[model samples]
Target: MAADALPYPLRLQGSGIVLREWQPDDLEDLVTMLDEPAIARWTPMPSPFDIEAGLAYLKRAQTGRLSGRRIQLAITVDGGEPLGEMLLFGVTGDRREAELGYLVGARHRRRGLATAALTLLSGYACGTLGLGRLLLRIDPCNTASTSVARRCGYRLTGEPPIAQAGPYGPTSLDTWEYVEGLPGPRRQRLRNVAARRYGRRP
Candidate 1:
């Protein structure tokens, strides 16, 4: 699929939520969500996540979208109440891969929104973008994220703890990596359906 043939986002609405692009106004809600310790502990965020930092990150996310390297979505109910955020980063064209990362607000945990949205996005990536594989990385300690990956049919390939830059300071983080592909019989059936409906071949 050509880049122009795909909708950069293509809003997804279901389960009383709409997953769409990041907006300047969303900074306030995101700031509040990031301020929660539940979200901060497992993910990488500044020690004291504040409004200013949130705004800056929002701007960077927009930049990432414009450059065609990333998609950062705001998870919200259909009526505009914010829930959380999810991101897909295109790692390499040669590799034909993208990485899935997400965080749900404390109040929205245990709902199927995360898994559902992820499933939809994974389909879009494969069907619309013609990607062969999607990579999901989860912090070793984040059982919720790991569970989401497993439930969505990603197979764990490795467990490696590596150092990466963080908001506060450099820290070692362990992550479990998983991959999704369209080669399997079940995935091929779904891909065929998407091709017929979306007018594109994956």
Candidate 2:
């Protein structure tokens, strides 16, 4: 339940993909995923995301991991080129809750990478990290991400969207929750999927 609950150079693999910590060489891929109209419209990522912004992001990711505030990982295949990113952030002081976020490049949509990446991270968070709850905030209009969250057993709390300042501009976000030990068919199914794919979680 400490900030160090997340190890450095973290690598979690499952559902035919690998999610690992960011590296210096991943700047291009990182920028590619963030520097898009849809990414900007749907999420809080910066517009005109470029190499320089990616460098700053990498530094923040390292600091987040070391300080136990958050963890940002690159979603890749076979540990090769980065396809996108996944994050576990907003870890509460009690270490009982956190948030999940992800993004895939424009070319990589519809390939199920987002779903696979979420499933892997969701399992790692609830199983190994032992967090009591994991949640995500997003605009309801982003059906792609909303679908991924539901498929991974997150349910909308039915509360109103919260308005806040994003890194780029004003944003409104809907909250969804995925609590540990929640009894339901979808939860069980995800567990089965994780077991079948992630024989070892680390």
- The prediction achieving the highest lDDT against the true structure is 2
Candidate 1 local distance difference test against the native: 0.68
Query: lDDT by residue for model 1 over 49-86, one digit each (tens)?
Result: 89888988888987777776777788876738678887
Q: Give the Cα lDDT of each candidate.
A: 0.68, 0.79
Output the lDDT of residue 30, model 2. Answer: 82
RMSD of each: 8.3, 7.0
**The CA-based lDDT of model 2 is what?**
0.79
TM-scores for all candidates? 0.77, 0.84
Which residue segments of model 2 deviate by more than 4 Å?
A: 1-5, 166-169, 183-202
Superposition error at 133 for model 2 (Å): 0.9
- Tens-digit lDDT track of model 2 for 183-202: 67755654454334324222
Error of 1 at 63 (Å): 0.8
